[model samples]
Target: MKSALKISGYCLIRKNRVVLDGRVLFETGPMDFSSFAAEAYLHFNTCYPKFHKMDNLSKLGFLASDILIRDKKITESFKGREIAIMLMNSSSSLDTDKTYQQTITDRNNYFPSPAVFVYTLPNVVIGEICIRHKIYGEGNFFITEKFDAILLDHIVNHLFNDGLALCCIAGWTEVNGENYESALFLIEESSGTGSGIANFGPAETESIYQGI
Candidate 1:
């Protein structure tokens, strides 16, 4: 059985769509998180992920890390903040896997691109997020046949209480060729707002995904 999670802010995104349904107001991407970043800056109280294609693990890590900061005013908000990233997917960087194989197979592969090679693993996203955000905290990756909201909720709840991440960017970044869907949330502990958990109930997951 998964333990309960504590979440404050919940921001969801899907297919370049940024859904602001909670206290935090932000954006995600239009092939990049630039617009999302811009919105966050304006709001001064939200979190958004970084933008990068390939829908790979590293990118997901980078995305989550970008949002876990406390003091948006601080030069280094991620500093001293623990981050627990819970990710879901189907292919699990299979795109990178095939690409790497192609790179190695080419006899004339003069430049063995280490950059591409690094994103082959599922956990690379976790590593990238931690490194970029300077988050020295707990991280976990889950590769399932499809998106499971229950699993995400369970993991996030535990991490919050354990003090792993003051907030989390948890969701599914599934890539299928050029067509992909990303439903992510910036989950955090409460600060004077109502318990975000109350937002949960039957069809709650779908509602969050819908951004309504």
Candidate 2:
């Protein structure tokens, strides 16, 4: 059994910037979320074409997870059932829901779009990440009023303690239209089999996120 849960890597997407493990990799100077996401996607050279069609929420989580999965190369060390993803946010897909509501709100123009309808749930972001990375371990999306580091810490530990997961992609992802912020961390064992994998918990996670 692993002795401790460690944070392998972290990525924060906020203020039109992308910070991966304390380094600024990409920044869209003074642009809106839509434009910033497009530029960041292209800048990172991510080949996921479906990225163009994702709602703002999915886009935020995708690009942030992309840094850890593609940039930090976590998938190279952990894959399939060994990797899990757990995330929480306050908005709970309300941003996309508002847009979907518009499709059916007006009597004359009540035309619902299946494409827009698909992203009405907050879990869509997790599904997008899981499908893209092929991670089959426990994936959960929680709705919280604020950043609950204690809650995130407990859930992640439970996955590891119960031997249900080896590595977990965890954090907070909240998106409300043009206003969005996400902090994702890759959690692993502190003194386990991996090298250069830094050491875990709510305080550490909170500090890493707060610094960004």
Can you give the TM-score per candidate against the true fold? 0.66, 0.95
The digit string of per-residue lDDT tens for model 2 on 1-212 reads 54587787889999998998888988877988999999998898988999999999999999999888886677788768898899999989999999999999999998999999999999999999988988888989999998899999889989989989888899999998778999999888776655533568777888887883
Going through the candidates in the order shown, the clash numbers are 3, 0
Q: Rate residue 147 of model 2 by lDDT.
A: 86
Task: Report the alpha-carbon TM-score of model 2 versus the true structure.
Answer: 0.95
Runs of candidate 1 exceeding 4 Å displacement: 1-7, 22-57, 60-81, 108-111, 161-165, 190-203, 210-212
Candidate 2: pairs in clash: none
Off by over 4 Å in 2: 193-198
- Per-residue lDDT of model 1, residues 1-212, tens digit only: 43333344444444544344453444455554434434543454323343343234454334433543342311143443555667888888887787777777868875566777877777777666565556666767788988787787677777766666665667776655554556666665545245765443225665666555
Per-model CA lDDT versus the true structure: 0.56, 0.88
